[model samples]
Target: MNARLVGSGSDTVVLAHGYGTDQSVWDKILPDLARHHRVLAFDWIFSGAVKDQDMFDPVKYSSLDAFADDLIALMEEVKPGPSVYINSEGYEGGFDISEVEQLLSSIESDFHSWASSFAPLGVDPNDPPSVTKFQNCLKRMRPETALSVAKLIFLGDQRDMLDKVTVPCTFVQTTNDFVVPNSVPGFMAKKIKGKSTVEVIEADGHFPQLTAHLQLLEVLRDVPGFDL
Candidate 1:
């Protein structure tokens, strides 16, 4: 259960990468972050490293609560100390997280409009991130793994957990990003109890790490203690 660990420092900053990418997506910004805060990043169980397909039991990490738990566990193992920075998704969505419950409810009760409640990203879902490299990586994902994860992303509501995190949090939301959309970031900021900042970068791609790295880095540095 010892998740991947990277970097070290008192002001620990964990990077939570979004769907279709792993910890390495932060490669461009880590050097800058490592300059000041301890940065820890890891791939979620489905992002490719996990071998035990059964280990990805739907009951466990199939929800945001479970995924966040894995994150907290990694943080506890690497740096249990106070963290001044917790840069998450610093960008947009895999999809409407609450959609899973909605879909299930709709299915069970003869409702037909639940799926429509989700706001589309206003982009082609079939198209990959604007970055070619990311598209290439995604095209190579294990089909079963991706399908399983797609189902999981549509499930549950864990935005409430934001109220529990005592650490300072900053989300890097892209104004022009499509996959995660803008509203998802808004929901996250409102739910997380601690002081959180949101920077709306004028970026086009969902993988801002590649298409909008400098802007993201600029915002990252501008955030309170992220002076790294």
Candidate 2:
């Protein structure tokens, strides 16, 4: 796990990048976030930025729980004390089984081509640079690793685990995300046992940190525990 800590504060914020993205995705908002809190960002095992290709095992990491375990271990070693935890999960994650299968099939058939086609759809097409940035992130990943991780993310259902989340959570979402449906944040808010709220940034893509960094940062700063 390639992890790094930035800034200094009594609070800590861990930046966990979504699928097909690395720690670099947070670059736009990192400086502002670091001004108030220690931010920890890292690349996932499946990420292309990882130098050690052998670190990822398809069989062992067939579920999101394995990834969560890796994060927990990383946090333990890094000792990012008393951080505000942010996460999202649910059965209603905006994609049906058929949709997921189609996406996986597309990636399996030709990942590079799929990534080029998918990147614009995921990010705002108007922001050509951000779209290209995301596409490059996708293209950098090993095909096999990308396919396996895609399966794990699209197929896995973790609705039962929501009730176990007893800490406060702030779900930041974009107004028009191609990947995640609008209903997800509300569904997750209702399911989790903790006090939770959804902050919708008036942005037009899945990656607001790239396309709408200022708005994303404003929302983060307003989150209850992060106000400091």
Candidate 3:
């Protein structure tokens, strides 16, 4: 649950990463963002960065609600005010239980193969170093943890929570995300209670922040409140 607070400013922004990767996913954009605002970045224990086993309780992490609660707690402790939540696709609203379950099953069966498949979908497949680095990152994730977290995502329905959200929110959708289909963003945009924007970026993959960092950063900067 430890987090790194970077930069120095009166305002605060929290960067949340999604499944299969850790806080480093935001590395491409952190420097620029940190120059103007304080950025809080942290790794979920299962993210493989936090090695302390005692920090994670298997039973507590069995659901995404637990993760949501932790996010609120982190915000309350650090920023304690209206904060922007820049989440990856699946972590936000608009998820189909069946589709996610199948994807999870595939990942559990072959983590490396499934992880590497992103290249063909739009990632830099030809780059040996980046490919190896991504593969190694996936390999660090235990299959059990992946399956458990996936189940937590697929089985959980967060639509009600969206109705409860009162802050200005933005959902960034990738053009060619294999895990989350094109329909998710629209579905989420309609369900959210507060003011929200669903931005469809030209990036072509689930992990656009890693594969298409510049384009993603451009889209993020243009987001209403995150222009900082």
Candidate 4:
């Protein structure tokens, strides 16, 4: 159960990558953050986990809470409370009031923009988005299945944990995000009721690690109270 760790400094900062992208997504931003703070980044189970797999089964662990539970457990072990936390496209909970969810649900009976966020994996930073890859990820997934995952992620009510988290967090969000939308981070900033910064980095795609590395790094370098 060895977790990947990076950076070394007194001021600790952690970055959690979204579903499709791995911890490597933070490669560009790490050097910047590492300049001042101890940084930790890890891949969630479905992506760059110790053991990643295709298709997340709801029966085994069930729900994003399971992944979040593991994250909290791991964070407690590595860093009790970070001076800053960068949840790329992960955790669409508190301070989350995305109109996208409402719009999606209205148009289709089944809509899971949060879960289907993995779709952006088609766009690699090195390669960017290929028409072929984008069509492939979506080609197999049905609207109902996509919606189910999205609902689970977007509707994931983790407001309870927000009060518990005493760390200063900086949520770097995208402009027209689907799951972890601009509003989600905005809602979180106000609701978290702790020291939290929302850096609305305008870029294409949901995964900032791939689309907006420099912008993300700027947020890390200039984060309030964090010297890193």
Candidate 5:
């Protein structure tokens, strides 16, 4: 459980990276965000940047709840309490089981090709260096580890926990998001326990923090607690 804190401010912002990527994806928005509030970003145990592979327990991480527990622990240790919680990829949960199974199967067979398919609508699909870098990091994991986490992420359901979440949530959904559909955020806003808003940016791609930083920054600026 290692994390890095950026910026110096009264408020703290937690940048939580989703599956298949590391916290370095947030580099684009970190500077602007750091100017306003403290930013805390961490690499998940399965991440390539994680030096301590011992922290990752396959059985414990077999479910999404384990990842959520890690985030909660990071927040409690770093900031000691709650703050504006921003999550990438709507975990409100929506994915066809067959589609997920097929994708996972494909990723297991050809990881690079599978990774290259997620390039945004307007981005060059000729396997950009960004995609290469992303693939390189993910390539560090064993095929079984990647597939296991992917199964948990794409096939697992977490809508039941939506009602249990009492924190303020801002679902930053990107248009043409290949991983999580555009509708998940709206579904999340309707089901979450506390105040939750869906901010759909006119950006495409799964990793908006990397591909659509400026637009993401604008959307974050208008988020309820991030208006700094």
Candidate 6:
């Protein structure tokens, strides 16, 4: 894990990138976040940007639990004490298993073609630069690795795990995220044991941090500890 610690403050913000993206996806909002808090961003083992490709073992990491374990270890190594926690799940995460399988099939059949088409669908097509940026990120990944991670993300469900979350959370979503259905954030809020709220960024696409950073920042600022 290539973990970086930036800025200085009483609170820390860990910026975890989504599928098909590396920590650089947070570039648009990181600076402003750093102004008031410490920000930790890292590339997961499967990311092409990670220097240690050997670290990812598909057999061992077939679920999000493995990834969560890695994150816990990374946080311990970087910051040994307690910190604010944020995280998720589904009543409808947007796609069903069949839909996810179709996506996986497309990637396995032709990753390059899939990335080209998927990137525009994942982000705002009007934002050509962001689309290209996301597409490049997707293209950089090893197809086998990408497919494995995709299965973990798209097919895996953690709804049973939501009740275990006890920390305050603010679930953020875009107004029009093609990948995640609008109901997801609210559904998660209901499932989690913690006090939770949903914040909607008025934007198009699944990646608000990339295409709607300013709005994303505003939403982040409204989070309890991040108000500073």
State every prediction's TM-score relative to the real structure. Answer: 0.70, 0.95, 0.83, 0.64, 0.87, 0.94
Stretches > 4 Å off in candidate 4: 52-57, 76-83, 90-151, 159-166
TM-score computed on alpha carbons, candidate 6: 0.94
Give one digit per residue, the lDDT tens place, for model 3 in 89-150: 47543346676666777887887677676434434554455456556655567767767776
**Model 3 reaches what TM-score against the true structure?**
0.83
How much is 57 displaced in model 6, in angstroms? 0.5
Regarding TM-score, does 4 or 5 come out ahead? 5
lDDT of each: 0.58, 0.85, 0.71, 0.59, 0.72, 0.82
Query: What would the per-residue lDDT of candidate 1 be over residues 1-228, giving only the tens digit for each residue?
Result: 324545666667666665555666778887877776676666677665444545565566556667768777777667547665443343234545475455445533432222222112322233344344454444344555555565555453455566787656677776766556677777777777778777788766456676677887887778775565
Q: For residues 108-207, what per-residue lDDT tens digits would candidate 6 score against the true structure?
A: 9999999999999999999999999999988988999989988887776778888998988888888888888888888889989999999988899988
Cα deviation of 15, candidate 6, in Å: 0.8
Candidate 2 lDDT at 2 equals 88
- Give the Cα error of residue 56 in candidate 5, in Å: 2.2
Name the runs in model 6 displaced over 4 angstroms: 80-82, 85-92
The Cα error of candidate 2 at residue 120, in Å, is 0.4
User: Which is the winner by lDDT between candidate 3 and candidate 6?
Assistant: 6
Report the number of the highest-TM-score candidate.
Answer: 2
Residue range 13-44, candidate 5, lDDT tens digits: 88777666778878888899889788888888
lDDT of 2 by residue, 134-195 (tens): 99998989999999988877887778888998888888888988888888888889989999
lDDT of 1 at 54: 53
User: Candidate 1, 107: how far from true, in Å?
Assistant: 20
